[model samples]
Target chain A: MPDSEAAVRKRIRGLLAQLYGGDSFVETVSDGISLRQAGVSSHALVALLVAMEDEFGFEWDDDVRPEALRSIESLAGHVLSLQE
Target chain B: MSGYANLARLDLAYREDRRIRVRDGVELYYETRGEGTPITLLNAFFLPSPSWRVFTEELAGSYRVVGYDLCNHGKSSHVGPEPTWEEHAADLIALLDGLEIESTHLIAASTSTILARDVALRHPDRVRGVVLAGPVFGPRGMRRQRQVQRAWLRTLESHGIAGLYEHMYPEVFSAEMNEAIGTPGFLGFREAFSALSTVDDLVNGLNRAMEDVGDPAVLAGVERPALVVVGDDDFLMGPTAARELAALFPHGRAEIMPKAGHVPFVDDAEGFQAIVRKFFEEVDARA
Candidate 1:
């Protein structure tokens, strides 16, 4: 079964925390804030994509599209889309 | 007097990881594994010490493999002032001294070779051997160098390393080698590299890389054994550049790694490690 949007967003924040080595900055950001505003670079996005692959059990080819990486909500939407 | 040639198997046991503050209050992140004569590895421009994991793990069985992130790069403090190759060389020396390693072999990738060349010449007694993988220290003329740098800087600014990778990988790696992107090893590398903070360092590192093309007259004086290895399909800097570099060293030799890219170590770790093992044994032979 697919995780609810809230659950998916929480997992992403969790992965971001791990990737940033517990920096916690991403977790502190407002839900509506985009990842780029959260200071996640394009390099970090690739890392996050790979981490999501492992955590969510799906493989994504090419890079994560810009729109999908814009905000936490967008990311959760992307994950849900992948599941569907 | 390390009987390097006699070792039939690498132990791959024991490991040490440390963060030491060297000269000028710069903190460096370093890790070591296996045992025997030490071999220090300097990573590529953008990636950090973790990029050396797979390659180092393979060699740790035979010798002590030390991998370190240059200051401002990895777990190391990015809180330092502007950097110079000379200062980077001194940092390497201080870090080695901190590790209690008097002299050891060196394996460097891409722009990291600048400091490797610096320290090797300034303190040759401290470097037992050197292997410069896909070195960019050649005299490629200012215009061409500037052109390449501008393109990369623009790409990095606009799209980041992911975009930069997409734009450059085709030029850097062969089609077959590029296919390794989805491998577990490469995935781990991508994760590690993403932890880094900003792109300013990449620009600085590349700028510093193009600033100094080592003088051939001085490189010829390097008495220690040196090897320049580039991938056969490395369009960026192929065998010609490698041969040119090798010709400058009194004891230097060059080889082209089959079916690889600008960074052959990442493309074919087995072939890269074999080349390094042989060169290391040769370096030990003279000792």
Candidate 2:
């Protein structure tokens, strides 16, 4: 079954925390929080993509726009779109 | 010595040769200097380990510099044919194990970037950080590789190392260095690498090696702190690819050396050293 949008967001938040630092940054990645504003390095964004691929079993296609990696919400949306 | 047979042997005589046995019975030749954070110096396509003698001399004061000739290059023993980047990574693992080094920073240039990246992705835990100069990935900017290979092979087969130098000189060095190509260092580089043409194993490996790089997934998976340095005027890898490569790493950034070419360390050694030293300091601070 497909995970609900909220669950995907939560998982993404958890992955970001585990891969990057801790819960402090995880709490800030809400819909309004831009990844840049959240202090995400380009490295962290790539790591997030890799971690998501490991969790979701779907590799990111090259056609995906750079904007897709702009924020957690956008990333979650991209992941959900892939599932669908 | 087959490669050095016709060339002046004075410069080549200064380098001390040592060997280590990797898996599959391949012996790789390497050199080391100083004692600090272990930093492995990887060579460019045509140049051997001693090509890095000048750069290593400076870097050795601050870091444990391990400069090695990959299998089939320089004095390194060739197992059979050119090994894949994966196999090269395996050889590196064995080399590190043989040296009793668990983890180290990779300071690589040109095609060695692919080797470094393969090792970093395959064994992230064993890499502390990466510093790449004129870095090239396989899939990106690979369209020109075939042309390059054809040119290299033609140069090797036809005119010998002198012609090969004239063929590649413009692409490898800055315009300033090109103007003064007769300098001792530049002359030595031409003679030394030209001598490399006589080594049968180093021939015919370019196309195969270039094929193993440029995987987007693997690039994205490298989680180490990486500093990608490129010559501002480098047309081979270019600054755009350098920037893109840097962005692919989780903790990555790029620097462009003004008036430099593919071999920035040779073109602007002082500036390159400053940049690398600063990056290493930052990496050490983070550690």
lDDT of 2 by residue, B1-287 (tens): 21112121223432676889997678999888999889888776676776676555567897899888888777888667788777888988889999999889888987788788878888987888888888766336455655775687677678665666766777777786555433323333443454553535535466565475366666778888889999887867667777887887889999998878877777766677788888888887898
Q: Which ten contiguous residues of candidate 2 chain B have the minimum total lDDT?
A: B1-10
Q: Which segments of candidate 1 are over 4 A away from where they belong?
A: A1-63, A66-76, A79-84, B1-17, B139-146, B180-192
DockQ each candidate and list the results: 0.08, 0.01
lDDT digits (tens) for residues B129-225 of candidate 1:
9998877666342344446666877898898866665566566656655564453223333333434436777767666666775565678777788
Per-candidate TM-score against the hidden true structure: 0.74, 0.69
Chain B TM-score list for all models: 0.85, 0.88
User: Can you tell me which runs of candidate 2 are displaced by over 4 Å?
Assistant: A1-84, B1-11, B138-141, B182-189, B197-199
- How much is B60 displaced in model 1, in angstroms? 0.6
lDDT of each: 0.72, 0.72
DockQ of 1: 0.08
